[model samples]
Target: MHSAGDPAPPPPGGVLWSLAGDIRGLLMLPAALTLQVAHPAVGAGVDDHSVFRTDPWGRGERSLRSLQLWVYGGEAAAEEGRRLRKLHRTIRGTDTRGRRYHALTPANYAWVHATGFPVYQHASRYLVRPLTRAQERALYREWLQVGRVLGLRDEDMPPTIEDFWPYYRTMLADEVEATTVVRELLAVDAPVPPPDRGPLTLRVALRAAWPLLLPPLARFRRFITVGLMPPDAREAIGLDWTPRQERRLRRFGAVVRVIVPLLPERLRYLPRARAARAAWRAGRGRQG
Candidate 1:
């Protein structure tokens, strides 16, 4: 600590610069953001107030806390109550298209204030909630609860979610990065399939992810909150709706039942459905 007139300590070598670099890394890595966006319980959309940007190195001067951020994610978000009012209109809409979910896609980048579906296929089981502004810093605090409830740490966050892309220019970059990585990873040998694979059911992955979140989520209140909604909202929440997500979590505790183990391990050498039936039979055989 120092008196008001004491000289300030030298900053960590480019600490501000390092943060800026991380911002670029985050902006350029959309998969991380999409993962977080799609993470546990697809949201109604990131609560509008939680998105913020603080620039410590502006050209003019050092005026900390003086940055007046706007609700400017897009044209529709420029005003304070405007965004929420509009969201209230849509979220409360009851028509067919109104009931339809509005998700962000590479093809529809121009849609203002748009967001992707609730990406967390198993999030309902975790009882995820929306984050407030203070929790939005570099997404550092947002993931803290996700990590704690889901048992994750700050370092575990994907770079895409950590960067703060305040305005339009970088938001585009965020999407580009998320889509590109998904494409490359979906290539022939990639562990995860590309988008054209028709939304690869991370259900298996979610099942895999369950073990990671169980300890916390179990002591934590698994499903009751999600099942509060009707069964139909599954797609809207971005879940593959594998049994693990839709069925009660207590039914899944301490168990990992491979939904369809007989499916061809390397694409199709035979009718995939037959393989599934055979797998089911075999599983029953062992159980019997």
Candidate 2:
């Protein structure tokens, strides 16, 4: 199942990019963004230009939409990548400590891009399914293509998926920090968006109950986010990660793995992914 955004599947061993269009990837968003902002430059960029504070969910929504289009959009995805690369070129500034930063810088872009592989790998264990080592490597290679399309050079990416973990671990140990912006993201105090297409009664109930639910939900979000992090990364971000928390997170993941597949397609995937799956299924039927 190929789409214009990501027109070709990874030759055979790549499962990560193949599943990039899955709604399951959203499970990794918090951790991915958290780790990216660990870089002071990325954090500073968001502080200066991103509307995350004012509209957290909206910012995430737009980011995810762009990714979906890039993966499933084909020629349209190329245009979107070009637009992003052009947009990023205009975003340059100095960090608080007088360090200069540019969104288009290969190193900066690569750090954010590299984080996606591990996030997807980790989240897939529960949100969807697991992959073998060969598939993981293939996924990593496929994303290298994505990085190139987004303006990163080959040298900017890790040489292989095997190389990515050491690089990722080093970034966590040496590069990531909890900036003020990251602290705000980890706080998770923003109101949850009400359901987009649920029954009016369900939406109304959720809206009315949200304030009451916010306290526990916020804690749960932080807990899960931290639980998803490695000790070094969690320590860098100053989030607590205890054995008890790990147990709870594991149980939650177990529940999701069992339940998510049972959800209706409308509930399980975003619109573009739903369409892509439908197209893939239709193509498979024709092949059959």
Candidate 3:
């Protein structure tokens, strides 16, 4: 239930609107999720409560949809925020280090959200054009607004882009670790099942070929997940990235940069984003 005075969703043409809905955004998501679970508390919550192992594709799809809604769902954004907070209320457990944890503890919850900014900033250097300094600040400000929509206080996040880096660095140094979930996410043999969505024929084909497909898919997953992470944060979490891998990632990104901008709107933007953008354009046309 949003009111007239409630903070608005990210504006339709904002940096988040442009980036969050873009297909390239999916490449950054695994790195962000990996970073989030590197924190023991977040790791434990997902390990114990999430069905990510049994339903990796479905989980990824749902998470991506929630992310899209945060920027493009308009009034639905605030309601989604409330639903997420409520969803996590009972997700309590002991982490790998035996520390008791709750999913919605301000710091833990905030850390999960916080991973997005750095991952976006870093990965954009390769997958999309680097953000200008002004664009970076604007992105951070808009992200903070999204935070507010998610029930985070002003104090829950760093107040500005300048303040955010130090806070992020401190978190990486003192708290982030290669927790069990982190290892699983980066594992090449983690036993993720074939995706169950799509046409029955496609699903069956995937299941039949999964044994042959999983090996390379897992390697690529690890490559993109670690390669897209901020370098210092990747080191902090102790993931290895060789120079050869770096070159490979750069070549891949170069291809992506050339190709993605050529895609049609319907192909480039996710479904929710494409629809919202259409609505915003129509409303603006009526006013004009």
Candidate 4:
């Protein structure tokens, strides 16, 4: 394990390095989570322990915070990874059909780890800037390196990004099953404004009228999530996608491309990315 004081080596200079910092990546959270839970074992683990139905936004935010720390928190990142691994070690249980599931199991862990590469890649290409083919390959490899930190062996991953699609397709075809948990996620069965966070104005409004707004918002989110998923994965989860949905999703992505770039850096990235950028500028200043 990497020591607390010792800086974990930086991730590769790749598309991930650019996309990891963009706020647009958050838009992929639902699709990524959907893919993760598409695997029966992974879904079982989440169904057993995750509080998504009660507090989905909190669950999502916590997941994002851990990922940000692991990917960008430098010297402290490895330690955070270790802590998470340790926590998950205690989360083992059987599914409704009595099949065993372990969150720490290597294959299960790797499945969740593998899903993020495509999510961020698509998020960048559709919402930020598109990467070159070589850059895409490099980004995929960087995530493989992250897999090592998350306790997955190299054998657990596809040999290359080009190879990953076949593996992903096979998983969707052979292993993914939509459980009740998947249905709940598709229903967006959790509160917005999180009940504990967000702007006071929004919080007050949501608290006042959440019952009226949540169903429509849930339908809207489900539509986008289905559009974001791969055809095979979308099919595995039985989400309906259509030409109209595709057009709307593309139109939304175009609007995001224009608006996101206009936001200030503080609003555009997570704190870790902002810190990384600040450090880079400071280092350049010293050399000058």
User: If candidate 3 were superposed on the true structure by all CA atoms, what would the RMSD be?
Assistant: 1.1
lDDT of each residue in 159-259, candidate 2, tens digit only: 88778788887777777788877787777675555443458888689888877877787887677676665566778667777788777877988888888
How does each model score on TM-score? 0.18, 0.85, 0.97, 0.90
Q: Clashing residue pairs in candidate 3, if any?
A: none
Q: Candidate 2's error at 279, in angstroms?
A: 1.4
Candidate 3 lDDT over 1-288, as tens digits, reads 876766667788988889999999989999999999999999999999999988888998889888988899888898889888999999998988888999888999899999999999999999998999999999999999899878788899999999999999999999999988999999999888898989999999999999999999999999999999999999999988999999999999999999999999999999999999999999999999
Steric collisions counted per model: 5, 8, 0, 0
C-alpha-based local distance difference test score of model 3? 0.92
Clashes of 2: 8
Instruction: Write one digit per residue (lDDT tens) for candidate 1, span 110-222.
Output: 22212211212122222222333432342333222222222222343333432422322233333222122222212233232111212357546555575555455433222
Instruction: List pairs with backbone clashes in candidate 2.
Output: 4-73, 4-74, 5-72, 5-73, 5-74, 6-71, 14-138, 14-139
Candidate 4 residue-wise lDDT at 239: 77
Alpha-carbon shift of residue 288 in model 3 (angstroms): 2.2
RMSD of 1: 22.4
Go through the candidates in order and give each one's C-alpha lDDT.
0.28, 0.73, 0.92, 0.77
Best by lDDT: 3
